[model samples]
Target: MGNSNDLRSKSLWMDIEVAPDARPLEGDQACDVIIAGSGIAGISTGYELALKGLAVMIVDRGRIAGGITARTTAHLAPLCDDLTSEMIKLRGEEISRAFYESQAAAVDRIEAVQKREAIDCDFRRLDGYLFQALNTDSKIIDDELDAVRKVGAPVHRLVGVPLAHCGNQHALRYPRQATFHPLKYLKGLAEIIEAKGGVFYSETIVREIEERKDGSVAAKTDSGVITAKAAVVATNSPIVDTLALHTKMAPYRTYAMAFAIKRGAIPDALYWDTLDPYHYVRLQPGEGAADTLIVGGADHKSGEADDADLRFEALEAWARNLIPAAKNVTHRWSGQVLDTIDYAGFIGRNPGSQNIYVHTGDSGQGMTHGVAGSLINSALILGDTAKWQEVYEPTRKTPSGIGNFVRENLTAVKNFAEYLAPGELKSLDDLKPGQGAVVRQGLSKIAAYRGKDGALHARSAACTHIGCHLHWNSFETCWDCPCHGSQFAVDGTALNAPAVSALADVKTGD
Candidate 1:
């Protein structure tokens, strides 16, 4: 039997040893711009702002690039995850063109930075393919091709892919897309930012962001306060906004697994399918180690179901079915993606806050949207204009997405019914070591986990964010909120937001 003390969940992309480090905040620090996250959005924005000679400070609750950026497949595709066909249907032709152009420009910016800075992160320009499965309609392919062409994508129809068991006969091949090591790129950018006089602080959790009447913003963290002329909330979901941003976007948990493969077993290109929850694939040159093939998909709303292991299983099955040689599954991890109802990201000024900006709702295009957002935010903060500024303005409303907004919010509201339902376990005795369960105790639910020594640790089941009931996630070893996707560690320290506060500890006897 395997050791019960081991939970066995981690990101394969984060297996690298060397990374940039910074000290935690000690006292009140000041800068021209304070970024609350250190993922792609925060780092890229900080880097750009530093280049413009702005005194920038980036802070994160964890290590730099430790959040969702490390969880990305690192595919820098010209195509958007929400799909060009869907964007055309939701936002029409003009807005779709703008969205496509912005992502394309973002890819170009990444390539340019790699060249200009001489950063070595395995950045490569390769072809990308979006194909249809045997059961999917051919018209979907036609629709996507038409939409991408309208946006000036260098793509054409392909009769078939040159891979084993790819399951598709028709495809759209887009040239000049790219992929890279996300964390390595972040490290390069962080070093440059430091050289340019930007400051970075890790393990500094910001409790809240306050906008003063004097036109300055202060981020209240556990260590100290950080005052700045402007603040950027680049966290995957906005912890600062309770209702405005949360209601417009829904959080989804996507699973990815890296498989050990022989070199050249799979073609060195990015591949995606037209499945509802579509699969995305890329080949990573493992350097000295075994070449890795990364495949990601199996997305579902966060905390909606406690089936992470099942999702990983399905993903592996899909990969093995497509590529028989992908036999060894090396790593599996899940990351949250915020889906915007409007088919684009919100990357400009936050609503009702003049000095505060946000970059959220990336819709599974974090690598592209993160950098694109940084470019727009930096330009706007410098009192300049970006050509696509209006495209991602946070306050803009799209009538077309009203249906999605209503549907997603309705689902969130329905999630509240979990509070009234029966708990997953009748008593703490039902919990196994290294496992957690929600147990009902005298009209209240308690999130209970058993340690390896069989001692019980308990926390209030109510989410610190909204009062939705919390679910025990066995794979991640965390208490996850079904309503807004807030996650807490086994000991109840908040790990993710829309919940900044930790779950209240509960006395098992009291």
Candidate 2:
């Protein structure tokens, strides 16, 4: 496990390379809608509205599909990371059915795009299995199957699955689930959107999104502004309306790896177990070209721990146990998932704003949720009635999730007490090159990182999101906030949202 490949820092999907460099926003611009992300959610929304003849502009801080989108396993299952049983308990049967149908339709929406644009992203329809892990009780699976029946989703029980790993466990199977090359599909969608007169600006950072007089919104960027009739904060987390959303959702880090396997080695199906942090498995075609057996699991609270090496080790062990034909791990990466207090995602207008909209809290189901955002938000923007609108309304509260919310928020409150706790290192002398530690100076705490070139860089230990002290993540080489997962690079640049401004720099001598 210690000999794991260092390529784990990047996603396996990056192997399917792309090079599209759109110019950044140079001056003031205006459009029918200003979308502040370039991932599936933003692009899907832009494409849908462009079909309706609306002028749309999408801006990303980096390249397209370079963020969390590239890091996905690319499973397009109606099955959510949250169990159907839990969904029924939280949202009731009707809303849960709507959630399931919405995701199923999202898969159909992807298929439609592939057909309409002639995308050859290896799209395939397959069955999905939810089985009991060796340690989990069988009654849990039975309960879930019953819940699926109650929700009217088409699911069946399977006694003998093809995988030799789970020899005899009864698995619940959902047919017509799917998989695809996410980047390739995005490339096709980007081309179609452009052909339809939609504009995209990569490497353009949106600093702020605020409303103006006469019922319009303005997204401020480094070069200029984008004034539009409406705005969509399709970033993984909304950069605007920081407090309301961040408090309701918490960030989680999940690890994934792709191992080479012979073509036809495993069935082309999605597999999941019933563990607390259960593993998910899927197979992709790459026989002579080096096929992939993608598996992901081992989730933990972001910034709360620095255990990537151990997490990857656990996943590799699980893969070997279940996938006998698995070879040396070719690609490994970790992705950030925002766990909403509620099971469903939020895809509607931001609370307290008229023209600004947001789509986030995918709840570990980014692919379906992203498309659902496009379906729901675009309808809201177009003033059309969307069927699943209330189910995913941004303002909807979950009384059932209140217990989990309290527990998570209490953890956040405890992290704020780090201001009084002793620093991670007693002094800078204990720090190594390319390592970082929080140190106390007088009464203030400092985040100090020593570069590989022997230069020391320091910044305020307080996270700009909410003043929670940042912790050093050796695996990612960033200062991560335990409170809301705001990450900063070694030199104090904000790497992710909910926190737009960089950390205040500190002068570090010696």
Candidate 3:
């Protein structure tokens, strides 16, 4: 795994330690259930199973809770982030209603868990506002109001939020939505799980997962193999499957920035606009003179764009336009979300495996999806039928989303075509210190990165997951695969899955 030196930016949550003393797996271990990732989903799953008295082991390639969960803005809204109207159009009213109920339950579960565990994670339930953007039709708000009502969620029609300008803007108010300090919550869960005998292995990479003939699953790592009655691959992108789930989802890079603002300058609530790529705003309570206002938006296909500085600038401008009292930028970071075709996650048993399960395709609702998916998966593992299983079944087909499926899968077709094109640079010499690029060397393309200290690291540009061409992400300082959401560090170590192995080193003189 890459270290702090490899990361170009950090999230506000990185200031806290989640599992500071956590160590990698040293030898063979056996548990009733093994989870491959330790973000909120994996940790939450372990908590659910551990509560049921099952021996659980959660492993991650990096520090515990250091993955995308730490990068999240921590919006716990149960309503669909992508608009419930669009979701109902694709998944139908029945499945969409079930989806809404399950998501609400997840939020309730989090509330109950924090109170019962006494986790003091700054968890709070507040009203959420969905307002119309400037120059946009108010019909969207009406559609959403009707759709949310059809899904059985409480909503109130409104006109205007506590922001600058537009006192008469059409909006809908959703009561009892939530926000939290994600890392703190996960840290509490990690401690509680550990106290309950759940094991955590940080900096441990699971290379492969195989289902045995005797109905047990084995997770093979470099150090040893872990055998379990069942396994869950909750890595943001499922590392176990190459095609099944990957084809149904696409990766998107979303940006978030926090700014300092005087307390009481803005109400403590979740505010979102009705835009294609919507902007979200919330406040994080501070102990000092000013609280932190987090605003997130500016989403594009991962690996397709390298304009993060511009995106951050746009976000800052948008924030200031709405809240003139917004002060200096405190933190800016980006995270990847796996958007499924139908705007819901795929959480269930792996398509072809008996005991192997997966939880992925967060679709921008990761905070709630993580908890909701855990409930569904844990129930199935305990031999009970999950109420919303059909809504999120990994193997289920979405005939309604065929158009979206085709449109998203085209990203792969276009990416593969890049292989035949010239590299971003003609040679490695063109790369400068603290910079990286894809350089052409004869017929092969090399991912070349020069450290701030002027050390050259080179690797194959092809993604280990499916040989898709790699794109350099200037913001995160990593190579991203547009095909399957694999991310590699400057040294070619796979940072995110569905690619477990590092990028192959380019041979000398190639």
Candidate 4:
């Protein structure tokens, strides 16, 4: 487990394949709408609107379809992992039925995309599992199974031989659920989007989106502006509307380790545990080695701990217990998602704004809810009626919503603490090789680093997005935030999306 391979860093899904047509936003763009992300939601929604005769434009800060789509475990199933039964408790059986139905439709939506476009991303209709562990509450799954049956989703009790000892209670089996390569499917649809009159711009960072007096919205970018009738903030967590949208969705860090195990070591069906901090496992096709087992889900508050390795270790132990013979761990990586208070996603107009829509707070089930978000926003933008509109409406509220809102707001305390926390090292010169430092300078903490060139350089540690302090990440040689998931290079350059703005400056001596 201590081997570097067991705790891999980059995305296994991406390292294995290549999508050559991927490009960046080159210049100014104009269209009926400007989609702000290249993930599944942004790409698919843009394609849908393009086919409907609207002139659409898609833009990404980096290469198209390179964000979450690149690293997703891609569990394409309709079993709402968290919100299925919670909906029944909070709202009623009808909304509960709708919630389950929404996921079922998400599974079908992926299937429909593959069929209609004839994509060859290895899309397969397989059984999905939500297993209960010893530490999990059985009542939750019991209630969810009833909803699954009522909604006629393919889920029920099934006993798995390999996992019978982990307090193996009755499982919810969703039949016809799928698994696929996210980037492959997205790249396939990107072609269709362009062919359907949609414009795409890479390297074009959308700065701000606001409504004008004449009723059109303006999307200011680096090179030029895109004024459209409507705007969609599909930039993962809605990079705009910082105070409102970021507060509702708290970021959670989850780890994934794809390892090659001996043949027939893992059961083919996708499996997930019902533990408090759960784990999900699945198998993917591979060659010249053991089967690739993707074990994921060790959720933590993003950037708050900085001990992702410990979480990765916990995952290794979990895997060894299930399959002690497994070895040759090839890749390890992590992703962050916006978790909602209601344990569901927020998809629709950004509550107070007019004609500006957002889709986030997907929890760990981002794939299914992401699809749901696209449909919800598309329906709202087109004013098409759908039963899912109300439940996932951005303006809607519940007791859980209020609770989640408060829970997410506590990050303000973490951010406040960062401004005052003690330095890890005395000074920039003290930084060891292959290391980064955050030191205080006139009440402003600077993210100083000893570069690979062995020279020390410093920059304002303040995150350009919302002024949160940035911490040094040893593993990635980047400055990461416990706040809204903005990542930056060691020298204060933006490496990830949603920030789009570079750090203020650098002061170097030594």
Candidate 5:
């Protein structure tokens, strides 16, 4: 809240600085593998490859581990967050079982890595509760129980969780699910990677990734180029593929808030509901006498909503009703997740590229997907075989998920049609300080923002990803593209990808 133009809000995990000594790339470089992002997936992949004695160079447009990973609630649940029942309907039982196995293995990999590296990031195994929301049908719990069991996960049918007003609620308890301080874990992992000869470059933007005819991949950045035997695009949204992968997934904006609570107020476990946009709750052990209760929900398609305050209010009301012991809010922020039509990450080789690989499509399970993708992509890069490869194949198609595919793609169609609609404001004069609006000007839609300092910043309302219309996200104070999850700063710099370039500036007669 200090400077809305800089950052709208800070996530609870942003306090930790990762790879503090890392510098931006200055010139041409070479490595066995070049990673385009430094999030959990990128760092974990680097750790895996570096352990094998491979020279790894990781780069990011921002600070290391400062992307969406820092904004996540750090839930390491391996079960399908979108509902295993629905996933089973889209993917067969065999594939669904493999998906679960891979996700669970991701959690296991985190446990193993933390132990091996002696990283103390509050890593612990806990029970996960998927209970029925108040007044909602209990059949979701039953169906999930059956579907999860079919996937060979250890789930127990139970009644009620350790929350108020949920004494008689039907629930499923999945043990061995995990949670952690993502920043701390990544910080330790980054140190370990560096210690093992892996290099990290923060504030390095990879503009284009190309697989050269010589069988090597080159990541072109503004500073220079990085050549490697292979490359991985771990950016939250893959910037390499324009249409194929983008069409298979949709972006969602999810909100989370943390509240102060007594250490023993609520059990240390993961809690989620059976609601469509399910509520997820967990506890983080604090240094002082008070612990932190983190609750998240109220998801909507990115760029489709600008009601984060209302969403936070809804979350607070729901949390207070269920856990009356929750105290004052400590931190509140939001992150974006890409939901795939098939409910699994797209990990492994990028389609049509031999030396280039991609890891994306978190599907609301970014933590697990990131670790699992690290393992899968690292193996594939090392010329080793991964058993779960087919489960997360980037090029694979789910014929059964056709309905979901159509439903999600319709968002783009509707978004494209918005280009013809009138802007939110007729002129920039209608904008007030600390506010932003799309203004119609001479047949062009301009994204206009009046800063708190009385300065006006204007750019094209069209997203550079595909020229789809951009919408102002008041909560995050950024422009969100409804088409493929590209986000731009108020000053027109692209924050998230599928779009690397900044928004085109509008010519204003001053």
Candidate 6:
């Protein structure tokens, strides 16, 4: 459910051979629990359920781990994106500390599983960084440091990070944060679950979920239906109907571009900017047709930004400024992050619904949050009231986060209002120098655009990969499919992977 027009044009996320095929659910299946969306979260939850000796069915709309998990920049840090001090203020100190501990514990649990299962997903335990480079002499540093200390993680001040003229002088570096090939981890876990008699169905889109009188839920798939006592909506954004889950978590759109680089670009330790639209940088040892430096983060809400290439150019300029030889941007992509109104994620039942559960709003901490959500969802379905559950209750509101709620929600309402204004499309003659509009053609959906010279253009809005709606990525001047990694040029030609097909002819003068 992302901007598909610009999305079907780019191949993103350190790609590897994790095979996923659309399969029909055969026969009426009965399971103790059914997990939706087979990304890191859903797969991890399925693996846990299988280990607990419960019959489980893990289903995904597309390939396994192909959603936000692949689109992710893959930074697993306990820093919580916003300053941890802000988290302590938004949520209580105890809840903030629990959030930090849960992330650390997720890393620990993932590492332990990889050791026991012997899965090689390049899971490395590196120290995570919250460096202050731009706003160096700022109080954010002291505030973040204070938050770090309160959370029980001893962070050492990196006094000697040698930089030439770039003044990222002081930073709070915490030990034992991690990096990994997310697909490899999830795919490997899926293998283990199947070996233990759990089922994983790729391309198995769950269209509807019905809760029966006895609280048993029936997951309606295209091929057949699955009857499970409990269901977890682990799809990156919870595809199932969830009350207030969507509103509580706003989708933030961020970009990542990979440039070919040497092995020791930044040396293992991950980096993120502390700016309004922050950029996060890391190195992929042996990912693509070439080794590349992945720089991500130029965040906006899902449909907000009006241009994407400028953001890419901005990242390029930043890299050139930081590391002069950074060029050959081989991979360029974007992914949506579900950020919670409060600092912590909502990981329990859907407010009033008894059998339904959701795991979302990780901010940018999905890697750890998704894994932790898996653990939390399992505990919740099993009726095991763990202490962490209180911190992540889906329905729980933060008295402390009221200020944050007002600010973020007001921003949302402001942005959402743009959709209701007078149409940006002022007929073909009145089109802008370079812009696109969604126009309905009978039963067909066409993405209409004007070129740099104001020439008219049009093409199919449906992602050739799977039929998720495409949003106009004004930032990229391309169509972006939120469901998977696909982008298309303004001309409607496919520029991304997993969707090799090009667009249909435009219906000009519409």
lDDT of model 3 at residue 436? 85
TM-score of 1: 0.96
In order, candidate lDDTs are: 0.84, 0.85, 0.91, 0.73, 0.91, 0.71
Look at candidate 1 and tell me the lDDT of residue 276.
80
**Candidate 4 segments whose C-alpha is farther than 4 A from its true place:** 1-8, 15-27, 134-152, 158-161, 164-170, 288-290, 495-498
**Can you tell me which runs of candidate 5 are displaced by over 4 Å?**
1-5
Give a tens-digit lDDT track for model 5, residues 1-510.
113325667888999999999998999999999999999999999999999999999999888888899889999998888888888999879988998999999999999999988998999999999999999999888888899989999999989899999999999999999999999999999998899999999887899999989999999999999999999999999999999899999999999999999999988999998887889999999977889999999999999989899999999999999999999999999999999989998999999999899999998888999999999999999999887999999999899989889999999999988878988987788899989899888888999888888899899999998899999998888899988999888999888888999888888873
Question: For model 6, what is the error of residue 307's alpha carbon versus the real structure, in angstroms, after optimal superposition?
Answer: 0.9
Backbone clashes per model, in order? Answer: 0, 1, 0, 8, 0, 31
List ranges where model 3 is wrong by over 4 Å.
4-6, 508-510
User: Candidate 4, after superposition: displacement of residue 269 in Å?
Assistant: 1.2
Please give, for residues 198-301, the per-residue lDDT of candidate 2 as tens digits. Answer: 88897677989999888999999879999999999998988887578888888888989999888777788999988988899998777575688999999998
Candidate 4 per-residue lDDT over residues 1-510, each given as its tens digit: 012122225786664332345445455556788788878888878877776788888777766765666667888767556646665666666766677678678768888988899987767888777777655567767877776676556666765436536545656676777887777777788778877877777756787888888867888876888889888888887776766666667777778888887667656778877776778888877676567888888877766666778888999889878767568788888887777776677788887777788877777777788777777777777878755877677767677457667777778676868778777776776877667778876667878877565867577888887888787666556776767777777656665545667777766455
* Candidate with better TM-score, 2 vs 6: 2
Model 6 lDDT, residue 7, Cα? 30
lDDT by residue (40-109, candidate 1, tens digit) is 9999999899989999999887777777888888889756687888888887878888888889899999
- Residue 159 of model 5 has an lDDT of 95
| Residue 157 displacement in candidate 1 (angstroms) | 0.4
Better candidate by TM-score, 4 or 5: 5
